[model samples]
Target: MRLGQRLRTIADMVPIGVTMADIGTDHAYLPIYLVEQKIITSAIAGDIHQGPYLSAKNAVAAVQLTQHISVRLGNGLEVVKPGEAEVVVIAGMGGANIIDILNSRPEVTSKVKRLILQPMIAAALVRTWLHTQGWQIVDEQLVQEEGKLYQIIAAEPGGSPVVEPVLYEIGPLLWQSKHPLLKLHINELIGHLRGVILAMEGSADAVKLAKYREYTIRLKALEEKIRCL
Candidate 1:
């Protein structure tokens, strides 16, 4: 089975010979691919909705991986017991949602060896949560698929908190690694910030003005980072 560039990048972050639990597994493609490649011998494919849960079950059955992969329907980490998986993968969701899932089940998350997260938006929130929870980001990758760019973050237990606030938004590992998409990513952020600032240019409300100033500062920081890049 083949996985998309985003999913493949997420899969690449998984260590070999470890049990994995894929939250919001959708069709269970990631687990199936990992199992087929022998990266993991056992996995739990979990989804919240019935359609996806059944789809994941059928996919595992069609591939005859039922013995190795278990498909469960439950919310977030509730599908897997504590210490059941070495790695937990949460992808194709918003950053806030991912954070909520991790926050929802401390027992499950605290015991996991690693977390592979792919948040479609508000990635900074996810990064901040990880840092606050003492999960050191080990790797970060960018993959553009169908004109959309996705950020994949791999983190493990025990790491110091990120000091720079901007690093949370831009991803410290991505900037340090000098990812090929860093420039484009910065440009996109700058563009969005500019739009926000422009829209609030004539606002007389104090709250809006404060937000406007905040965005201006962020815009300037992004501009400086782009120049450095």
Candidate 2:
């Protein structure tokens, strides 16, 4: 039941003593581990793909947790019923897919008490969606697993009005708390933006030029903010 750093980070974000549904659950490792540790009472492991669904089913049976964990073969929140789980975890997928899942089943999602999301790409998009859709990014974690950085967001059903652009680009909690990895992540983003700006310098495309200037301006602001930090 050993969870990798990425999955472990997501697992750590789950509140204790609440039933959960793990969407896109490949092998049901997180649910199995949580149940074994007594961190959760029961879980639903849902996977869209047949191979992974069967794999998860076998994994759950191997551990003799058939009664505690329900392994279902369905896409996104379709497998999750309203009030079935207080928390829903969607991990190991792109941010767009996570957003789609949430949007596809707002009826079920609205009733969910918490959402733990780990977006492999386009994390900012996920944050933006959360903000605009009435969910709050309550907590966030940045983890570099096997040399690749991953962002995990934990959200609840409510939030106050927020500034979209800033919260979307930089996590609300991460920016305010100044997490230990914030500086590192900012530096990496700055470097990447700088490279993009440079590549766009020789281009005559108006769109590219506009984006280049925008990124350059943002780069300077982020640099200055980092200096203050």
Give the Å error, residue 89, model 1.
0.6
Global CA lDDT of candidate 1, please?
A: 0.91
Give all candidates' CA lDDT scores: 0.91, 0.87
Residue 180 of model 1 has an lDDT of 98
Q: Write one digit per residue (lDDT tens) for candidate 2, span 71-165.
A: 99998999989889999999989989999999999888888999999888778789888878888888899888888777789999886476636
Q: Candidate 2: minimum summed lDDT over ten consecutive residues — where? A: 160-169
State the lDDT of candidate 1 residue by residue for 165-226, as single tens digits: 77787899999999999988888788887887776775667336667777888888888888
User: Which number leads on lDDT?
Assistant: 1
* Per-model TM against the reference: 0.96, 0.91
Number of backbone collisions per candidate, in order? 0, 0
Residue 158 CA displacement from its true place in model 1, Å: 0.7
**Candidate 2 colliding pairs, count:** 0
State, as a TM-score between 0 and 1, how close model 1 is to the true structure.
0.96
